[model samples]
Target: MSPKEENNIRVLVTGGDGQLGKCIKVLEKDYPTLNLSFTSSKDLDITNKKNIAEFFKNNSLDYVINCAAYTNVEQAEKEPDKAYLVNAEGVKKLAEICKKYDATLIHISTDYVFDGYKNTPYIEEDVPNPINEYGKSKLKGEQYIQDILGEHFIIRTSWLYSQFGKNFYKTILQKSTTEEKLTITTSETGTPTNANDLAKFIINIIKSASSKYGIYNYSNLGESTWYSFAYEIVRISDKLDTRNLEKADNYFTLAERPTYSVLNKEKTLKTFPTSIENWKNSLSKLQNKMYDE
Candidate 1:
């Protein structure tokens, strides 16, 4: 085969309906060389081994971007089993299938894996001590991928939001329009990552096709508490005067969250030729995009 033919890659993205998945779909147009196939849960359920196996048998895949995850933090505490079923066991099955098919697995993880005991950012080598059921479940998924697949890139991100799906960014924007008073908590601290930025980064990794496979952290440059994030959103939307936004030291939540869960990106920076954007700048960009749309 010619060099161009050999370089042509077929990528399968699971959970194509999620925020990150939808962002990837939007950016797929830019990478014409990549043969990208997106699948929703209805089409390919990761939790079902037989379903995954059947899909893999019929399709030729070079890489599998596993975006399918159980992401409800508060609900996970109430139903830990449901979280593990998708986040852990489902991911384990996906990893095993990817290994069998000789395909590279690009899995999405969360910084919630850390307990947020340390004041500084968490690195790839930092031992994960998840405090919540959601975090624990995601950590188990990461562990499964590491144990089952050698060719994998497990990216752990934080506070992910975008123009699509149900996220904090959308929530704040929605609340600003409806609610007169908004009380956001300062209990948890983490970087608010733009899903579009992360989607681009993941696509860039696939384009590079580099063999440096392992866990990596990818988030926007800065950190903020939930209150600060909401304040910024209100400020940018010009809703500060009309809407009453208050900061609370603590808020009642079903799941106990980390006080700080910022992820270090030194490894991702050194490995990839991409620059990370600041949280505020990315958020502004998304806000503008939402307005334009």
Candidate 2:
């Protein structure tokens, strides 16, 4: 059944405790019409096919926002099997169930799926060549959804940060308390996405109930290097001066990152048309929220 035909859209969100999941939960009040069920990994293990089958058997759903993923890029290198088990195989399991139930699936993906060699913003149609295990696993999951089901939306985002989780924004804020100066990477560039912004966008998609099912890119409107992002976090918070920011070609990471992963949002803008905030403006708002918390 089409989601719009349902009297009440019963939506299920996996990875309920993650950053994006928390953002969705906070926005739940705004979307009272949706019967949203948030499920953590423990609440619903996506990797166990039998368990998922049982759960789907008991519950009826119209849509699913799959927030579950093994997002530790560096750690993914050490445990590619675990990454695939969750990101690829587990997602495949979810897609199959969604197909069986005739539910629309909305999957969160990453800009890391690309090799970051191109100088231009990445459109949805660009060929994905992931440099890291995490990206490869995510791409595999996307492929599974594409091959298995026609009713799905795969959103590829970059540099996701939020107040609710351990993200780069939080890390920078925490470091400012103890460390007088910070060194950040300037070689690599990508758009910083606020989880709340992405959450709201997802909700808009569900609310629109449009069947324009395909891949899309979503992130804050501008691009920045890690150094500039860190600088903005500190500057907006009024916690430190710009002199505290230092640039480095690289620090240390177990996984290799792309030099650029800025996603093109023209398609998304045409679809949703909500005002996309500049990364700095979003950061300032987040800083205020963090202070209030």
Candidate 3:
């Protein structure tokens, strides 16, 4: 690597307002050696092809981390076009731009790609059989990146929650403090990943690992259903409103979520010896960090 490649690597991060994106911003300050450009949808819209093309044409990026995605699981059924446009088409556009500039692409994906029928932790090689439009669109996005760009990483994470943005922590924290009762589904099972922890892991991959250009699975250390997760969060946050706790098992509502999608992290551990925080432990730490803020 030349001085340009070694001294100050230029990095472009999309979806800077999201959970993982915001965590990356917080963590980037530690690595002042890299020239980083963070942009939300307001600065650069990934859905527009011309806007994406112009961006790549102007900037010389060594790495492009894409945190943007159409994440509304239930709403995606009503707006399939928007989901496909942003999740599928938007990803395709970004991958193409990265290929044009010969930059490494780090794309985040979800565990919804699986049909939720599996009882074990999902690995990177698991065949994706998505049920909902959201899951299908994200799976399609993954395929596009793999086919279009060779030097790219597709990290499949599950039950991602962060203190920033509209995550499970914020939602449950607010509701627990106000609601007299709460009913959460007990069927779903996956590890709740802290955005900050995952961001640090991403940074580690970029720094230490060479040619880390493949699919990977990452999340917190343990697993639990959404119902259990909500309970634990409230219990930890003590200011939780314990007045309301009901069980809503009516899957007939609309979207039928996968029963389990806990990701297997053997690869990440074997490669980097990463210290992934446990769900409850990480949740407490994340809440404390936010309260301090």
Off by over 4 Å in 3: 1-4, 241-243, 251-253, 290-293
> lDDT tens digits, residues 1-293, model 2?
54354448889999999999999998888777899999999989999988888888888888899999999999999999999999999999999988998889999999999999999999999999999999999999999999999999999999999988799988988887778788999989999999999998998898888889999999999899999898888877765677877899878898999999999999999987577889888888887784222
Q: Please give each candidate's TM-score.
A: 0.96, 0.96, 0.94
Identify the superior model by TM-score, candidate 1 or candidate 3: 1
Clashes of each: 0, 0, 8
Error (Å) of candidate 2 at residue 121 is 0.1
Global Cα lDDT for candidate 2: 0.90
Which digits, one per residue and each the tens of the lDDT, describe model 3 over residues 203-271? 877776368678998899899988878878877665664446566665353666788889999987887
Quantify all predictions' global Cα lDDT against the true fold. 0.91, 0.90, 0.84
lDDT of 1 by residue, 260-281 (tens): 9999999999999999999999
Model 3 TM-score is 0.94
